[model samples]
Target: MPYLGLIVLVVMIAALIDIVSSDDALVRGLPRWAWLLLVIVLPLVGSVVWFVAGRPVAGFSGRVGRDRPGQASAMGFPEYDHPGRFVPQDPEADAAFLKQVRERAEAQRRQGEIERRRRVERERGQ
Candidate 1:
């Protein structure tokens, strides 16, 4: 009986913490206040229902489960799953991208100088 009481107390506390800490968007089936009320009114049953239905499913990695097959993990944006996400995870790839940007800027500077020189020559001729 004492163990049962302890279990119920733990479950009630866990439910309250979960309700308070969970994002409104992630909670399902009912509003947070309603869930809180339910948990308070019927500790064991409400806590069970909240865990089974209201709370979002998370895996061992702490990533929310995908809603469908082939969907991205909820921890990141869907764009992160795309091939062109542009996350430079590798140092070599990051360096290469920086180099390309530098090269493009240098080219643009040279083109700007040439255009300025041509404009000056035209003015001189006039």
Candidate 2:
């Protein structure tokens, strides 16, 4: 069918997008550049090869349980658990920083409450 070529073209494009978007460190089988060339040169076969061989498996982080950072040392916050993330070395300084953050947040909440009450009073007067 004439539509077969269109289908192959779409599949090839999708494979290219996937290959380009995928993390370089996670790619298997061949290098990303090689896979790119293979897909461009062979279309259907290369797309199949990429899906079968090059794709990183679901939930495969490419790291062992022990190799993973913060398995036992997580700070209870996922975002700040990265290996190179800034962590205050001094415990007292860290505590002070957290206290400052809490104070700032409470002040902002009080300011918001004050503004809301003023707006409600003005609305009632009007």
Candidate 3:
């Protein structure tokens, strides 16, 4: 019974760390909720799934099951070189890109308007 408790404790700790530290957007398209469910509802399966499908370290090489290179390895936590890498992309980039597209569209609209005016003038012969 004591051994079983220890095992459960270890799994809970691993699951919490994995969920908290994971970048759901960066790696697989799965959500954190799914991971939480897996860990909470099913311990053994959840731990395996977490280890297999979790994010990969930026510069780590070889099999993921292996120990981390330099950083502390705790229940296969992926060591991100920069966690900010997973941060949602800058809204500024989206804004600037949209701005460029809008500008191009506006220029095209103005050119079309000028052409229409020229055509109308020619038709009126004035």
TM-score of each: 0.47, 0.49, 0.45
Q: What is the lDDT of candidate 2?
A: 0.75
Residue 59 in model 2: lDDT: 67
Where is model 1 more than 4 Å wrong at Cα? Answer: 59-126
lDDT of 1 by residue, 72-105 (tens): 6322334334322334456476566666776898
Candidate 1 accuracy as TM-score: 0.47
Q: What lDDT tens digits, residue by residue, belong to model 3 across residues 8-108? A: 76987787687877655444436787777777888777767776775444554332222344542222223323333232255466456556776898999
* Candidate 2 minimal-lDDT segment of 10 residues: 72-81
lDDT of 3: 0.62
Q: After superposition, how far is residue 16 of candidate 3 from its true place, in Å?
A: 1.7
| Candidates in descending TM-score order | 2, 1, 3
Q: How far off is residue 69 in model 3, in Å? A: 29
Off by over 4 Å in 3: 1-4, 27-29, 56-102, 105-126
Residue 17 of model 1, lDDT score = 99
